[model samples]
Target chain A: MTAARTEDDLKTLMLLSLDGDEGAYRRLLHAARPLLVAYYGRRMSGAAQADVEDLVQDTLLSLHARRHTYDRTRPFTAWFFSIARYKLIDHHRGRGGRKAAETQLHDKIEDDFSAESLTARLDLDRLLDALPPAQREMIRQVRLEGRSVAETASSRGQSESAVKVSIHRGLKALAARIRGEA
Target chain B: MRKTDDIIESLVGDLKPVARHALSRRFLVAILSSLAVSLVLMLTLAGLRVDMAVALTLPVFWIKAAYNFLIAAIALFALYRIARPDGDTGPVFREIAVVVALMGVAAVFQLALSPEAVYRRLILGHSALHCPFLIFAFALPVLVAAFLWMRAAAPADLRQAGFMAGLAAGAAGAFVYSWFCTENGMPFVLIWYSLGILATGLLGLLLGPRLLRW
Candidate 1:
């Protein structure tokens, strides 16, 4: 999202870095950090936020070591994302055992960004499962489905304030569960 | 959080200039070394076929040699391309299919021209029992050497990369084995030699996820 770091700019930096420009290399890594974090976050919302950061760092380290393998002629995003994906798979394998990781990577990589959305949805479902039915339904309608409070309250034949309270309590419970404090 | 920036700052502080040669250059070095060693081993242990002089005069012998060498070259090219994470396999897969189809056409012509008993003879050639195993044996060292180069290249898809490596080695092994093999029949060359290459490919597939896991 940095103004100075477009994909073309990053590609130029990568090419310069390959040519031994230490400053360009550092800039490239710095610029890539947020992109990598967001890449992991979309897929890791079901897991700890810390694990997402760890994956980003792992990818950066790999990108550093394998910088030479980058082809100057190719688009940098494809190269970078592919490496990010491999690291994500390796991290999962390390955590959940090889079978799970292998299956996850095989299932995910075919449809591109669908994998991240799928994981986020799956994680959200797991998180929502921990809440009571009333609260879960409120959060699902208001927070997930983006339904208006009035629409939700009208559908359920409840007052607007009661629906608002349910949404609030549901979100708080979800956060506590995510924080492992519930 | 600025976690990535902190890591970057630390990495930059410790960064040193690291010179890297082009991957093609490195790949050439590894493959050439492997082929050279395989050739030397083949010559030393198996020696040339007894009919080397007569076989050299024939077109089929040369075609067999050319076929194996061409496959080897294609596999090597695929290996280099796939070693990069961003590389696509579509082109190489198409190229491979075309080559295999051409070889198949050539095999059909060969089968048609030969006499009835020739089919049996070609299938049960004198080296039929040992040909696949010999080529497989020759491919072992090449596989090891290719794997070493691939590890440093950091292939994202190890299964495909390893398969390419195996293929390259297998073709080289078949080429070398051609010099020692007296089975001039195309069927024998196609079947046994292919099986030999497939064996290496299978080995690669098995080792792919395990060895190439980064």
Candidate 2:
């Protein structure tokens, strides 16, 4: 309870989550991720410990799915652990597991620009499209290209603040375009 | 297997972004399961009642139909909340309400019809949603199951765990609720039944840490 901020506060968070505030639910799930990671790590080979993180994410999913089953009157930790424990049982009980696939680290993005996407307009390529070629290059180099603004300024033989201003304007213009577009 | 510390940290941080999406889907599943139970009750229990003599009686038939319709209507109304990606049930009351409505339908139907007949038509005969209630129930589950199946198939890591864990957890939760659950009548459903289903969530949580492992 020492690291708990306040025991009563944590309890209230539990109560709020069980009561169904989406934001609180998200916080509750995230807060428990570390615990699940540690718990799953204990059951795994050291080299495979990273898989514990996967277990944490999976627990979030199941908790999300089964959240409705939680009674507000109960302790959040107790309710939270109940699902986690069951998931652990199933993980062990499961047999004939497949070997991990060697896949690219980068996630695949669906090319479809459906209206359903929340950040569909935020696609970097699309955002850059609205900027002039030099402005885009300046911004990309200093930002996505990961050069510091000073380095970018020096490379372009411009002052750092001027480079900053150029990049800032470029981003602003892009934002305006997209905001208007949206 | 690079085992580089930097790469591990990078990937770990990158994957954090996807967790919210995973949770949202799981929330959908949790809501769907309870809804499925209610749908089944609503469908099969049409023209349903607790007292057979009263159930089949014309006046009672309409009452049962209205009850079934109201349950379905509530589910439909709640279904709208579900359709809004960001909106979802806030507490266990919804879970219990759905269950109680479903169970109420069953109780009333049981009263009107013997368990033998109900089982004969549903289990023994293998009737696939022959009645309206059954049709509606089956429809909702089938649609939900399909969406979930497709979703799991396409995801980076299939959460076969979500469903498998959900069902097992659901049953376990029901078991726990049987302890705290007081079977009074409709009010029990309106209040206590939700408590029971929320209790089912306890099983989910107990197992979540292990079950969610990729």
Candidate 3:
């Protein structure tokens, strides 16, 4: 099946599960496991199989607990991936991973060519528009424009620290927007 | 640890239809109930200001209440949004900033219009020393309620979510305290009330990572 068809099917199953359809819920969980494994496996390259499976289970549990947070108006895949990404981040933090590792993980997650990641990326520009102009410009320069913080700071005639703070706040706002959206 | 299949089976086994908008409902219930508790606490502890009748007739009283109420409303919405795994908090933060900024402008205007001698009185009301602590005390119930509800939901950024919850609770507390507070100066509210809210937010920021580990 096409990726679009798969996502639609998953969404239908999720809706049914939300309606208390146990069978659909079971199928949904089953279908999601492989995707979770693949997702974690790709990023956690050298990690043991057991560790990856553990992370998958953790994500599944979180999904179950946070089911009520799922908005019917949102694309299910986006919601699923967000939760998945959150769990992955939590896992890394739990293990006392360095900030660099977390940053790398973020990059890998964004680089993912999965249907959900693509959908989320498509929504990124719209989400950025919701930020204040200053924050939006900072994010565009530092993140989308891929300029160094020093360069962005000099160009904008702002302190480097100010530029960093703006970019941080903007990214945080973008994350919040995404979670609020899908 | 249990196998993944086992976990799935168990999750499905106890499946129940969750009410739609359950998160919002839970947050609303929490805020309302906690506000009620805070109101009762305020009335019993401090009682309404002696000149409540006169104060009610004054525009300043309503202005203070309205300001706190607006902050509470916006912060509560932000709290609710951030409790969700994918919820957005950016817009609410901007909105709250705007509300505070407007109050700041109001305070500046009030300060400008007042006599120079009353400047200290306007900025530092009789309760300035204790106002923030009192507000923080009153905010406890709501903050506790918010934290409890947040624990059940999946928040992406624990510190940010906690701060939002604290801001909402603190604003609610300030709104309740306004009934008993005799301070008529906008600067007092702008300073003391904001300090109270900020302190609570800081507390939340400090506790979020530890309490919201789930």
Candidate number achieving the greatest DockQ relative to the actual structure:
3
Candidate 3 clashing pairs, residues 3+ apart or interchain: A176-B88, A179-B86, A179-B87, A180-B86, A180-B87, A180-B88
lDDT of 1 by residue, A1-182 (tens): 43224456767878777776778878888778867776687677574777887788888888877766777777777788878887887787788897887788778654554434534544565577678988888887888768999999999999999999888888887778878854
lDDT of 1 by residue, B1-214 (tens): 5777788887776666545557777788888898889989999999998889999998879988987888888888888888887675557767766767777777888889888878877666888888999998888778888998888887877788888888888888988889888887777777788888888888888787778766
List iRMS (one decimal) for every candidate. Answer: 2.1, 10.9, 1.8
lDDT of 2 by residue, B59-177 (tens): 43443334334433443333323322223333434653565566567555644565454544322223222222223232334234433433332112223323223333333323222
Error of 1 at A36 (Å): 1.0
- Angstrom error of the Cα, residue A38, model 2: value is 30
Candidate 3 Cα outliers beyond 4 Å, as residue runs? A1-5, A97-182
Q: What is the lDDT of residue B20 in candidate 3?
A: 82
Per-residue lDDT, model 3, residue B40, is 92
TM-scores of chain A across candidates: 0.59, 0.44, 0.58
Tens-place lDDT per residue, model 3, A44-157, is: 757455689988988998899889988888778878877887777777777766475468556856576455664554456457767898888888778875889999899889
lDDT score of residue B13 within candidate 3: 96
- Displacement of the residue A23 alpha carbon in candidate 1, Å: 1.8
* TM-score of predicted chain B, candidate 1: 0.91
Model 1 scores a TM of: 0.79
TM-score for every candidate vs. truth? 0.79, 0.30, 0.80
